[model samples]
Target: MRWFLTVLGVLFGITVFLFLDYALPSRQTVRITNTYNRLTDIGANAIFYASADAGTVQNAAGQRDVRFIDTVRPNGRPYVYRNEDTGWIWPPYFKYDSSNLHAQATDRKSTSANPEWVSVTSYGWRVSWLSIYPNAISIRSVAGPDVRPFNWPAVLILLVLGVLLFMLWRMWNQFHERSIEPAIRSADEAWDRIDAQADAARDRARGRVSRWWDWVRGR
Candidate 1:
């Protein structure tokens, strides 16, 4: 049972970590290479995108014109981001400026020769197998390609979560120490008393049997 609980706890922790990692905003410094609109089906990857009522018109076949921004890192690795309005949905970016972000990405487009670097703030993972792209929340031009902007939002969120977990841990320890431990100890003591009574009764019964047998044998 202990091993089972340990495995269950580990799985729950991993699930929460992955959910936060996906929901939290992250920054990437890359050069915008191109921007375009594509009619995407969304298909099974609809969860990765915003809701249907997020101002983007969707057809009966679940197809919509999705704006995509193509970018490349300083090391020449390519990345793609979907420009979409999150509206008042999960992740709580409340972004309703997809067109503006797309325009900004288009204006920031640069070639390798000139290389205009920009920091694109987004959330989610780009899973190629699932045809998932990170949704870009905002964009801004940066000084250079090697610029690493500090993610203050992520740090503050983590700190708050840490404090909350610490408080919960303290409460649990107190409960275990005050309530659960005492109850368990009482149960153990009750069992010990019952065992002692049973042993004494058995010894008394055996002594009576021995005395009766000796009297019947005329000793």
Candidate 2:
């Protein structure tokens, strides 16, 4: 019985561990990305505008054939838009591309570096972008931190099982204790009754022997 209890306890512990490790989302991460490209010949002086009903932007790469990469968001919504007429293209996901633009190119040796023309705005779940034409904007995905919520049902079940096991252990102990007590009491009672019977028999024998001796002497 002791060994059985020990085994049951061990199994319960293992079950709890497995449920938490695999069944529960102890750690989670999310990232979201959005990309846009300019279709019109809006010169460097003019700003390019692109709107997405829902999403986010990370970083932009390349001036013309730009590529954007980002993590998926927790909410899991990302959108992409492209201008069909200008040959401008924006991928819904991460990809590489190479294309030429009529706009001024930023030179590696130039003193006045071209501004990192990237803009990010968050309006609830929607993201928008604006930039000069002949250009493409790549918005990387967003990344979210890991999180884990406690599993109440599993916890409750474990608790209940633990309580039941404890109760069984207590009951077993009580039963053994009670069983021994009754057996011991019965043995003691039987010994007492036997002793009483032996004493009565001895007294009766002495009385008969004494009476017989007196009769013979008197005769």
Candidate 3:
């Protein structure tokens, strides 16, 4: 049972990690190569992309013009990202700044020869098999690709999770000390008192029986 519980805990932790990794924004230092939009019908992969703009209709077509940012990493590999407003659900970015971000990405476009580095803040994975790209949250020009952004979001998430776990631990300890342990101790004491009463009653009955036997033998 202990091993089973340990395995279950490990799986839960992994699931949480993957969910956060896909949901939280991370920084990527790359050079903007292009910016464009395309109209495509979202089928099964609709979940990978952000939802339709707020107050928009939903239908079987699932068709929308998705803005994209094309970038190349420092190692000259291409990275594509989708710029979309997350609306009021899902990842909860609450970001509705696709137009401004697209303009920024287009303005910062650089060629391989000049290679202007920029930090692209995004969340989600670029899984080719899944036909999904990370959603770019924001971007800014940087001096070079060697500079890495500090992951404040991850730090904050960890801090909040840590505090929650600590509180839970404290609550469990207090429950044992104040409730469970005391209840068990009271039960044990009650049982001991009951056993003493039974023994005393038996002794009194035996004394009465001996007195009756002695009077019969004397008469």
TM-score of each: 0.87, 0.23, 0.78
Model 3 misplacement above 4 A: 52-59, 183-219
Lowest summed lDDT across 10 adjacent residues in model 1 is found at: 49-58
Superposed by TM-score, candidate 1 places the C-alpha of residue 191 at a distance from the truth, in angstroms, of 1.7
Q: Among these predicted structures, which one has the highest TM-score?
A: 1
Candidate lDDT values, in order: 0.93, 0.39, 0.88
Off by over 4 Å in 1: 1-6, 53-57, 211-219
lDDT of 3 by residue, 22-101 (tens): 88779999999999998756779888887655433345677767889999999878999998888788888888888999
Cα deviation at 171, candidate 2, in Å, is: 1.4
lDDT of 1 at 179: 100
Sum up the clashes in candidate 2. 17
Q: Give the C-alpha lDDT of model 2.
A: 0.39
Task: Give a tens-digit lDDT track for model 2, residues 99-217.
Answer: 21112121111111221221221111112444322222222222213333344544665688789989999998898789977888899999999999999999999999999999999
Sorting all predicted structures by lDDT, with the top scorer first, yields 1, 3, 2
